[model samples]
Target: MTVPMERHIARTRIRDSRLGQHNVRVNPGEYFVTGDSSVMIITVLGSCIAACIRNPLNGFGGMNHFMLPQSDEGEWNGVSSHMRYGNHAMENLINEVMKSGCRRSEMEIKLFGGANMYVGTSEIGAKNARFVTDYLREEGLKAIASDLGGHHGRRIHYWPATGKVKRLLLTGGEDSRVATAETTYRSRLAAAPVEGDIELFG
Candidate 1:
């Protein structure tokens, strides 16, 4: 069974004194959706992708952070495995926003956070960028803006209600943190068990 979206929504909430708004930090394998203008969603990415989707008509939107392009077939037994892949991540975020009284036809899309953190390793960042690009095309959706496929990481702040985003490219130590976090996350997923039934795509 694929875990409910509630389990995947980011919970690390904080009050941004500078911005005077509530900010939620989204990690890999997580997403958060809301219609509230006061809430901002943020994430750091290294060889991962975060999709920002919102409905301009209703001011309802959400974001998803995922590390992989697609889950392996029959690898759907673990809850974390689901949202960690682009296919499931995109679908869930879009569905949640639509469920908040927004229609798919009214959605605006923005893409961010695919960096080639691993120098000589397999180009997972490129793979992720390619996957999302293909996924959006297959679903007949278009991104109005994007910053993807570089040699550095990025920090993203997004207001789902307004479809506004601020991106800060990570430098030196900041970039290292993102790469380290994703490495640990990937390790954990490798050790995690298969337990859900969500369909996988490539």
Candidate 2:
């Protein structure tokens, strides 16, 4: 069987910074941090969500993406801490930001990505979004802004000092924030499957 062309192409990009940069790859339990940097960017797509947390008073921020809700199934082993599940990802991101000297009360949130990359798969994006909103509420934090839901992948840039978020949509091509085309592209991709695809096979 022939694999689809789209499955072999790169769909994400990470920017370089003079201060330094940290990149987190999917595996259900891996995380990276920029230390005291005032700005952080996290990109995500397809049944995935990125939570951007910033402490305006401290001028520090962090972002994390999780692919699932929680690792209750025990298939993730010990690395479950770094995976992009809703509950674990949220708590870990918050804790890490606080440990870097950010106070919970002083921190603001800007959420993005959680795209419904997969069609007819139980609406994972909506479920992930709900999990994030509920987690924030339970933790007594407020979301200053958000660009979530829909079927388009997003590239999210967050500035901690200013608590500003910039969202760029991904349509398997040039980057922009257009909603209609991106949504259509995502739907098409979700409906196709490739044989022997191992990118996320674990």
Candidate 3:
């Protein structure tokens, strides 16, 4: 008998005096930013991508989760910054770190997630990883480490204060099922269609 599939949950916790914790489901085109000394966590599976960026010199960083490569014509909204895209995600991350008093030339990069969860489908994870690598080389940013392109989901934790990353694998195991369920719940909350002009965090 086929067993029921279990769910998964991805969580990121921050433990620094100068940092804050910001958690979000990170839908197709949404992104979140954490200040210096903070950390960001994003979980993903097939067809989705997340980029982790940090300034090693000053010990600060940020991450962005993007679903598609770029939006087609007639689908541009100004809710999230353009940096949410693979193309823009790299550029904007550099700019944000610079604005925080760090040099672009000294910035370091670490990447994770780009799983081909859907078997026999397009290699979206590989494409995403390529996009990020090309962007970094074109921009002259050094990539020190990476964990990309797989068939399983992943839970990634990024420390903006130190640029250190912790990765947790998610598989078809019972534990993974529970995590997946929790992730689904949180994703529903993050993807809830915004209502009439109301405060998001108020």
| lDDT score for candidate 2 against the true structure | 0.55
Give one digit per residue, the lDDT tens place, for model 2 in 1-202: 2211111012233555775653333222234344334335455455466777755655555667665532233333353321324555667667655655566777778777666665476676687687778778976889888887887677665655466667777785433343344355445534433222112100
TM-score of each: 0.84, 0.61, 0.63
- Which prediction has the highest lDDT against the true structure? 1
Screening candidate 2 with a backbone cut-off below 3 angstroms (N, C-alpha, C), the clashing residue pairs are 28-83, 29-82, 29-83, 30-82, 66-84, 67-84, 68-85
lDDT of 1 by residue, 63-143 (tens): 899876334534344533433456667877887766655666667999997788886867878888887898889777899
- How far residue 154's Cα lies from its native spot in candidate 1, in Å, is 0.4
lDDT of 3 by residue, 1-202 (tens): 2211111122343344454454434434444445534345455544456676665665555676654433232322553322235555445555555555566667677777666654454565676677777767866676789888777777776666677777887777733563354345435534443332221110
Model 2 spans with C-alpha error above 4 angstroms: 1-30, 35-40, 69-84, 172-202
Cα distance off (Å), candidate 3, residue 150: 1.4
* Deviation in Å, model 3, residue 173 alpha carbon: 7.1
Q: Which of the two candidates, 1 or 2, achieves a greater lDDT against the reference?
A: 1
Reference-based lDDT, each prediction: 0.77, 0.55, 0.55
Which scores higher on TM-score, 1 or 2?
A: 1
**TM-score attained by model 3:** 0.63
